[model samples]
Target: MHFIEMQATARAVRAKYAQVESERYGRPWTAEEIMLGFLGDVGDLAKLVQGKAGVRPRDDLDNALAHELADCLWAVLTLADTYGVDLEAAFADTMHALTQHLDDVRRSP
Candidate 1:
């Protein structure tokens, strides 16, 4: 799926779960709570990816990583959407530059 669609789907799932959690717990999350929740997920991803990290099987990390990464991406997309950024074009440009860097490295002695 395209990045924009993926981001929207992530937001929908987050909203649905937030509603269920709030109803179960008898309160909606405050902005601070939501930001902290996202921060915790960011830490989860960092734990998996940090240098010298104990590596697990890729399959084992997939589900948690997907959710945490989606949480981070959701925040970024929300910002981009608010500012009218063309995320698709930005991503393509960034990736093209990254590929060029890698190609340059491969060509080095």
Candidate 2:
């Protein structure tokens, strides 16, 4: 799906999680808490990458890798939404800059 569609889905999922958390813990997760959860997901993603590369042994390699990547993407989309960032614009600008830099480097030598 497109990035905008993914972001909308992520936001909906985040709202569901917030409701669940409020019911369980008496408060919805703060952005900082969400970020901490993201960090945990990132660690899992790193291990999965290692397993994919044969640097580690993992029993649920394929499924786990896909799940972790989705988790990371959800976290990023949610965080960007929470912080009022225009992620699409930011991504486009960043990629354009990188492409220009690479083109300049190639021309130089």
Candidate 3:
């Protein structure tokens, strides 16, 4: 999917995360709490990758990677919301720069 669509999907998943957290924790989280929880989840993913590699599907790193990535999106999107960033533009610019960098690397000796 494209970057904007992926951003929306990430936002939707974050909303679901809030619902689950409310159910489990007995209240909706503050921004700080959400950020800290996301960090903890990231650490959990690292531990899972290191310790339970066999438990993941196809041994696909995506299982661990996706969780950590989603957490990152949650933090970034939350920051975007707070600061009123144009995430689509930011994403497009970053991707373009990364593609150029990769092309440069590939074309070099």
- State the C-alpha lDDT per candidate: 0.72, 0.96, 0.74
lDDT of 1 by residue, 56-83 (tens): 4454566666767877887666555546
Off by over 4 Å in 1: 7-38, 48-62
Order the candidates by lDDT, highest first.
2, 3, 1
Kindly list the per-residue Cα lDDT of model 2 for residues 56-99, writing each as its tens digit: 87798999999999999899999999999999999999999999
Worst 10 residues of 3 by lDDT: 51-60
Worst 10 residues of 1 by lDDT: 50-59
Error of 2 at 27 (Å): 0.9
Root-mean-square deviation per candidate: 5.2, 1.1, 5.1
Q: What TM-score would candidate 2 get against the native?
A: 0.93
In candidate 2, which residue pairs clash? none
Model 2 alpha-carbon miss at residue 70, Å = 0.7
